[model samples]
Target: MTDLLPLWRDLLLGGFILLAYTTEAMTGFGSIVIALSLGALILPIDDVQTVLVPLNICMTGFLSWRHRNHIDWRLLGRLIMPFMLAGTVLGYWVQPVLGGALLKVGFALLVLWFVLRELRRAARGHVAAPKSGWWSRGIVLGAGVTHGLFASGGPLLVYGLAGLSLDKARFRATLILVWFSLNSLLTLLYLNQGRLQPLAPHVLAYLPLIPLGIVLGERLHHRVDEVTFRLWIYRVLAVSASALLLASLLQLG
Candidate 1:
């Protein structure tokens, strides 16, 4: 029983990481949110966060490299990075007190809201983005906080990006750069708090699958057009958001 337990745990962990990273590679975000929400059911949320942060940073860094030329360095430096870092500072402070289960549930609720909002936008045939200004900045900062706390800030950030009217390649590249920078800080924070020690072995075991998922995801990203991409993104978000919300509610019950 003991031997079988570890095998099952590793399998679940590997599967979640593969799926999440693939999504991240294709979309340039969503890996941490997707993986953490699902992985929390199989492993402790804190442990999953610790183990996955480093892996996510590494994966995003790789994707950033792969699409280096497409990154919006100006936007990342001027707005996204600083705002997201600020959010992480606040998120880290409140995380310990909020408790893991509540945090996960809250993140799921947030994602659900974004998914629904995007669906409504899509259905209305609304292509012109809202004007970019303070409101847009607020959205990005809000995404930063959620990201800092739960690592699921992609959907909110996507809303902000939509307003910028970026091309598909720039969108993915910019997201990869933003996550790489933000998650690098998160990894250091995890290390300082000693949250990563126990996860060392699991990290090594899961490392091999990371690149495989990224390669496959990269292929998919290249093939997808702007319209098809948005359609697929929301579809995935709706299903995953619903699943996470359901899982969190079950935990409460």
Candidate 2:
């Protein structure tokens, strides 16, 4: 293990780190999106995963606490534990095999596929939303696996929740809990596998950013209307995801 404080690794990278958490705090998502995209731009893919995985633990943990009560654990049992448990192990195993570039590419594709599918359904007025059920186990399991794989499970989940008749805060809050918990668990699992590295100094550099961003996001979220917020989030997911995928693919080529 080596630590190199290269000249290029400065406050801009640190600012990029804050963007993720701030986005998350505001919208209940975007930390992973910001981290993965910005990290890929400067750090190697492997380094990105190792570095940001820990940061994910912190950001998600905070959000989880904020949204703790919103999570429906009875419904959570239907989807989270069994679903992610398997996916968690898979995430650890897949990292070594796919390496960094492939993981980025894979996440991009998954995000795109889900987002566009949601868009198409919305266009056709087929967006019906998520209904709580034992019947929805298949979707929940599949969503868990996707979350396990990329932590970008938001595309599948966010859209799914939108289709449900849930209130705005409840939808976003539950997502915060789900993602924060699952990402934390995956990080622990990855550490056990020795794929995740400890990045204390790295995390410390941007630690202040998460809280700052969350505060700002909360401000923005309160100011915006629900319908407008959802629309903007979808747009962000589509555009941010497209940009990340294109950049990674270009790098690969």
**Ten-residue region with minimum lDDT total, candidate 1:** 98-107
Give the TM-score comparing model 2 with the true structure, all chains together: 0.81
Compared with the true structure, what per-residue lDDT tens digits does model 2 show for residues 1-253? 1355664565656777677676777777767766667766767655565566677677778767777777666645656466655655565566456545666677678777877876677677674656556545545555555565556566655644455655657666767777767777777766776765555567667667767777887888788897677666777688658867876887888
TM-score of each: 0.93, 0.81
What lDDT score is found at residue 52 in candidate 1?
Answer: 85
Error of 1 at 28 (Å): 0.7
Q: Give per-residue CA lDDT, model 1, range 85-148, as digits (tens).
A: 7877777778778645566677777777877887888899977476467877888888888777
Top TM-score hit: 1
Cα error of candidate 1 at position 109, Å = 2.2
Clash tally, candidates in order: 0, 4
Candidate 2 lDDT for residue 72: 67
Report lDDT (Cα) of residue 149, candidate 1.
Answer: 80
